[model samples]
Target: MNDINREFVSHDEALARAEAGVAKLAATRNDRWYPKFHIASNGGWINDPNGLCYYRGRWHVYYQLHPYSTQWGSCHWGHVSSDDMITWKREPIAFAPSLEADRDGVFSGSAVTGDDGRLWVFYTGHRWANGVDDADDNLEVQCAAVSDDGVHFEKLGVIIDNPKGFRHFRDPKVWKQDGMWYMVFGMSTADARGEVLLYSSENMRIWHFEQVLFRHPNPGVYMLECPDFFPVTDKDGNEKWVIGFSAMGSKPSGFMNRNANNAGYMIGTWEPGGQFTPETEFRLWDCGHNFYAPQSFNTVAGDTDDNTDGRQIMYGWYSPFVQPIPLDDEGWCGQLTLPREVFLGEDGDIHTVPAAEMAGLREDSTDLGVVEVKSGTETVVAENAEAMEIEMTIDLKNTTADRAGIKVHATPDGSYTYVAYDDQIGGIVLDRQANAFGDRGYRVAPLTADELAADQLTLRIYVDRGSVEVYVNDGHQTMSSYSYAADGPRAVKLVAESGDLTVASLTLHNLKSIGLE
Candidate 1:
């Protein structure tokens, strides 16, 4: 399957090849590190979610798939579809590296529904013609494929080549606006700074070069990989654009430092002439350790509503840059974050919460109603639930505790993942060193005074087999990280570290496995 000259003459030929690759996944189904509620590869490596969209009547999600092994190589588009974003059905491979143009790999891209109800995917076609050289040495081009029934795809061939003088260009994110389709590709200048190029297509075939969307002012060690642009409006109905990209090289200052590569977004306005005038600096988009290359999709189907108030849901790769996954030996290496709903505030601030569909996984319930804890005390709210969802409101206004919040995956041997709010520092601290598989550390995000009240610290936490995701105050802020807990009974605890703490309300729901089903 790794042979570059392998060719699939028809759709059936490609589907057969995909079936062979997925057949080996059953042996690793019982691995301890495999995620219970996330989308992961059947038997290979998956990274950088591609072509995420709602097509026909179901939600389709595509990811960078390396089918032959648990390591990176020539990639294809692995397909998964769901009625709701929570539970998914693994479809056959959507796009394979079978054509001569994309013989090496079919890289990251986005999906769009056409005017005539057809589905089109614009992806980066890559080939390893030369050995690893500078970014220009790799032959990268933007290619297109179309599907009539949202399953079988016909390669429409390369739509846009490397028009920029620099040779590094790929990852075409396409969206329709004002009767024309617009695309933005991730690229870098000759000096190696990250950049994005824009193009417009009157029809799906011919494309016209627009302009460079944005470039770094300083040419340090930086090359942007994935570029995503979409519009968001706050509660006040003021609209703005969110420009996002995955950055590599030296980490940008003020962003999260858990990983060297940071994925971020810029809040700004897209001018009439295609210039992005920023109102705020580039900010960390997801306050998590293993989140990157997030692609947002419009929920409406083709030629339907204008998508003015649709949900801004995004899915991201849940793996760090160079860290090896615990399940690599079992022949799979990556998983996707749970779908998150992004919210833009009136003042141009951004936050993300779990998608509403995740509620469907709740099965049984535990109610720890209105508990109170004194200083230096902790209480177990729920126990013996490996996969569960917990929600509570901490009265930060009435409490004088230096730190008070929830602890998850707590074991009898004094090991747990800690998520606490420190009023002394006015920030949330996510400490996972006790249970993390790799170089674990504490990650923090600021909690502003405006977000705190005597009885208003809303917290939502989702804990699965191997990961924990926290959403604060309906996504006013979020902290997501991965941890590998031991095999034993687990307890969820709420502690008041310094002073008195009051829980206005608390509820826990045992969640069924979204993948095992």
Candidate 2:
């Protein structure tokens, strides 16, 4: 194999080497835990998604790329495109750390379409001058690149420098509002309180700093990364703003309180003066074991006040734990979650459902209708399916069980991960403690009062080799997690803790691999 990093005079040379490396690995490597449908690095390493946008009737996703190895190092931008967000086409390395300004690495950012129909990318250029080990040595500046066509790009140099007195600053998320360009970057105060700084640009090149959009009030949070903001209707039929950020340090309170490395959003209203008025408290975006650094984009028509347009979509890095995977043997690690449609629920919460086009990947489906399980477990569909989609409705009102839901990824010995609705807490829990093949943890995300008031609950679950993503009540809530196990006759069962539990309807689809072959 060629040295991952050799001489690079131009972007083409770097791309050719990366392409060669991935092709070599694909020819001889097979990891059972490699996902069948998710987007992963072509060869080396990928982290937070950089730029995501719609161009010429397709969706393009750019991610933090280190083409040398599966371990973190200097960064570049890896490109992939999809017509329907299900099957992705890997493009060449779009942005690399070639320019003097970004010689160290090209970090995370966002993408947008210019008024003249050109595609624009905004990213942070990172360099460590004083020392690599000290956080005080970090230096990052916002930069821009332009592309006449979606595949090729030309660097435009540094656009914004680090403001005075800030220790770390990066991850520029740019969007257009009322015909003006607004940019938000993750930042922190000198005292180590995390916040987002706002800026406005009349032209794409020059930007003027505004004010701190919002800050984490908790003293335990040191800093926040990958901040994203957008407007959506709240549950009360009122338009509101949603801001999301990834936090580091001890777990904060109010939303999903368990995970120490927490990622969530706050529902609020934005004034024309650029200040945000939080309407409701902060909440967890996804209560999954491995979800972070989420970025969302609009793929179709714009969203209305009621969020009826159904075009807002999002994707998050599968995990930030940086644990070793079987695929490390092939010189790659990390993946992005499936694209989900985001909308404001009627209960003042942000909700996400699988993109509509995912249905196209369902090859053979079975309709298991109205099964009753009393104080036991029953296999409803396939004995076990690694890549499958299950949609079922549980009659919570009529059921007498204290707790009920489905058991998935079950081994023959009854060791399996459980996804169930806890009647006592009136929330959902995903237990992966027994499945230590990958990361082991339990995640619980609560449902709103309106969600639990219903007589029936609906669940849509997508399970691939190492991931389990569940959508509750048509995406009013969602939990996404990752796990691994050996391939065999795993059990897919309807579980009831006590008393009769009735399944109103169940449908299981053995999903076909999307571009995995």
lDDT agreement of model 1 with the native:
0.77
Quote the positional error of residue 443 for candidate 2 in Å: 1.1
The residue pairs found clashing in candidate 2 are 235-346, 235-348
Estimated TM-score for each candidate: 0.92, 0.91
lDDT, each prediction:
0.77, 0.77
| Model 2 lowest lDDT segment of ten | 1-10
Clashing pairs in 1: 397-454
Per-residue lDDT of model 2, residues 1-517, tens digit only? 0121222357677667766756665555556667788888756778898788777766788988777776667888888987766687888888777665566788899988876678888998776765364455677778888997778998777888777636668899988877778899888677888888899988888899888998888877777789998888755667788888888764645446556576778888896575887777667678887788889876532222332344778988876463545556645677888888888876657788998889998999898889888786555556778888999898888788777888788876556778888887788888887784666767777877876888888999888877788898888778888767555766687888867788899999988877744
Superposed model 2: Cα runs more than 4 Å off: 1-9, 24-28, 131-136, 234-237, 250-255, 300-310, 320-330
